[model samples]
Target chain A: MTTLTHPKYGAIWFTLVVLLGISLLGPLTGSTAFVLLLAFGIAVVKAGMVAAWFMHLAVERRLIWFLMITALALMAVLFFGVAPDVMRDQGQNWGALAAGKN
Target chain B: MIDLLLKNASRSGVEIDKLFDLITFLVGFWFLLAEAVLFGLVFRFHRSRSPRALYVSGEEKHQKRWIAVPHVLVLLCDVVIIAGTMLVWSHVKQQLPPADAVVRIGSQQWAWVFTLPGPDGVFDTPDDIARVNELHVRSGAVYHFELTAQDVIHCFSVPAFRLKQDAVPGRLIKGWFAALEPGRYDIQCAEMCGIGHGLMAASLYVEEKEQHARWLQENAAPPRELVAFRFPNP
Candidate 1:
């Protein structure tokens, strides 16, 4: 019955807390893109930590590994499916507005 | 039955109504079948003498209902529903409006500013009136609003018009709506701003093209003269 009280996990959680605090304050009056990218990167790191420790995938059975891999593949497919939407303009040309030249 | 089902199935918003109906149907169908089996087992396998409960580990090929047929059917139905939703979403997103007019919408502190290109294809002009909490548009016309916020991030939403757009500081997002009928719509702030978020509301008036123009002209005051007249050094 091992609990989630490990020092390494504590460090990771602390880092996540700090990152979240910074994210809350950064986007308010400072750079928005920096805050967004940092927040997203922190999320990726946190997800990795959760998968490695909380789920205990490192010592799990082979079938569980197969299921995790399949899920990841499906997620990848979904990501690619919606990639065009986030990347594509889809609307009017907002380049001039973005460039502060409008 | 067909008429009733058709009437029940015809509601807007997302496709939640039909999905709920389908889910209810599937769950009810399964519950009835399971209940019948459970009742039959209770009646047939009644204990007349000292009888023990059978312990059956369903691991073998014959014992295990591998790839449960009903579960597979449910998964297939979910996939079909998701695919159908995706198809509808794609169609709605790709359909470009024929007469879409771009309008600039700005949110600053507790006020809303709507800028319209005053027949000259230019936004900043004397004719442009900065209204605090009102937006006027013509009915049956696709109006695209470019949303931008000054202080904090705010969301411009009108539920009746099915419109929602985020106004981020230093960035311009967009939202569009086409009113089928002429009426007054409530424009509410969907995002949590500062203390005045609850009070952040505006009015959207959808009228005929001619009526909209006439209303703008009547409500807006004439622009002041640039040169100031003064009597100095007398």
Candidate 2:
């Protein structure tokens, strides 16, 4: 990977500037849901840029790519495994005790 | 001394202390043994002044069965540990508390606000008492806790209870714990939130059920005057 002064750095800076501008104004003028989605999208782009350019993960060999892909697949499975439990209703005391039901 | 960060013999916060101790001892011993073996081999088989070095393990079958067996054992232990911990974690997260007591905990930058539900089923009402930092709970009863954060992310951790959950901004996190003993416990902020993160702490006050009720009744009385009392101008 080249140094920060490379031409690619300018593109990165421009993208960051656009993201910053949108981040600053989007939440103030838009719904929270929209702002969250926009933030998440920008974060994905930023992470991809950092990994490919700065981390040099893009230039790795095929074996390293295979290992990375396997790790990502495992992470996806783990995330899906936990998503259901995390979304489940934990405990209800107030709702029950309020009705004199419990 | 080896278990410097370990809890005492008594059970309080989380009941997984024994399991944790066993796992810690096993893992710690294995690492020390492995490192010792590696260093011993390196030093014993060093090519000092001798020009020729032994090339005994060129053939796969010539490798020591002891080393190969230990390697397989380590791999098996790794898989077993991961599977076992995953099962325990899932079990802990899935189990629901009895539908009796519930407390609302609001975690801000430097303190925790604990709100107990009143007769009206709402928290922090005129009839309910708001406790800062310290939470009073009854022993042997399962208390369902609802967690909320005022600022950034912070984790509610009770080392004795072996229970922890993260409080996120704009989102509510929930976790439950039932303690066997009625004693004071430390509430730690496990997440590295910000500068004052370390200072953000709370105390858990567990008392007998009747005493807890009396304390609640004494502290939670409604304010005497709802309307302003003023003298009429003559």
Candidate 3:
């Protein structure tokens, strides 16, 4: 047996709306770093709700789960491969990124 | 190579052109070879010549060589390009020659202001020559430019010189170039800053020694009218 969601579509949609409002209003508190972190946390919750209830990922079979995981793993490999060049503080012939050039 | 058609007037542009030519030759060779092989195969295997179809599973060692050989060759080409690029980068950027003259380049919305050392060859003095959208330099002299942006990020690009540098706001970026010949060149902003980015262009005048000295001496006198530089209260 395999599972990827809930049948309560209306309840999930309402919860998503509430999370959106909270995330938008969270910036007014003036603690930008803390509020942004909280907003991201809310976004993860909302995303999970959408996937499990709206998109029905929770009810999908094991094959669908394997496909999704493979896609995510490939994306991670791409990120790690490119992150070094993008985030390099000091690299050979990086005259533009050297100290005091910023 | 396009270098034969497009003129390169700077010291480092010569080295860059060599690298460009090498890459062009290698890539062009591979491109032509691949295309010829593709069309040749198509013509050789035309349906009229043979009614039967042959299956290619690409599992055999012979079939595998098709992918492996080209893959290794392309990687070798990549290595050559990377090595040449690093050498050019090192020669053009990492090593800085002592400046014979220094120019201060200030970029803002829709305009560029250049401050060159006048007859005295000293900045911030009465002899300093400041002009808007016009830069004058003497040929055969190494000039280091201090580039900065007043409003937003802008790039100083000279196509003939193959020189391009970004002018970042609140930062002083130093770069150098030497004009080998005396001529006028187009100076343009390569970075998009505002609505007037396209119009943000200037002229670089590289003059002969005697001509440059004459121009320097002529512009030394104080002007009857002064142009004021002001900033609004933020």
Which parts of model 2 are misplaced by more than 4 Å?
Answer: A1-102, B1-15, B46-52, B57-59, B64-68, B119-125, B222-234
User: How does the DockQ of candidate 3 come out?
Assistant: 0.07
Q: Rank the candidates by DockQ, best first.
A: 3, 1, 2
Cα error, residue B22 of model 1, in Å, equals 8.5
Question: Which of the two candidates, 2 or 3, achieves a greater DockQ against the reference?
Answer: 3
CA shift of A45, model 2, Å: 22
Model 2, A1-102: lDDT tens digits are: 554433476787788778878776778866989888888888778777777666666765678768878999999999989866544433322111111233
The per-model lDDT (C-alpha) reads 0.64, 0.68, 0.81
lDDT of 2 by residue, B1-234 (tens): 213574432223343554565567668878899899998878876777445787776357547776788789888877866776665665455566463588877777777777776545565467765567778887777777877776778899876677778876555555677767778888889998889888978888777778777777777754344112111111
DockQ of each: 0.06, 0.04, 0.07
Better of 1 and 2 by lDDT: 2
Per TM-score, the best of the predicted structures is 3
Could you list the iRMS of every candidate? 15.8, 16.9, 10.6
**Could you give candidate 1's per-residue lDDT for residues B185-219 as a string of tens digits?**
78888898999999888998888889987876765
B1-234 in candidate 3: lDDT tens per residue? 546676888888888889998999999999999999999988888898867889999999999999999999999999999999999987777776888998888888988888777899887677777788888899988888877777799999988898888887655667889998999999999999999999998999999999999988998753434235321111
Can you list the residue pairs that collide in candidate 3? A4-A57, A4-A58, A5-A58, A5-A59
Report the error of model 2 at residue B146, Å: 0.8
lDDT string, candidate 3, A8-56, tens digits? 6788788889899989988889998979898999988987777766767
Q: Which ten residues in a row have the lowest lDDT in candidate 1 chain A?
A: A91-100
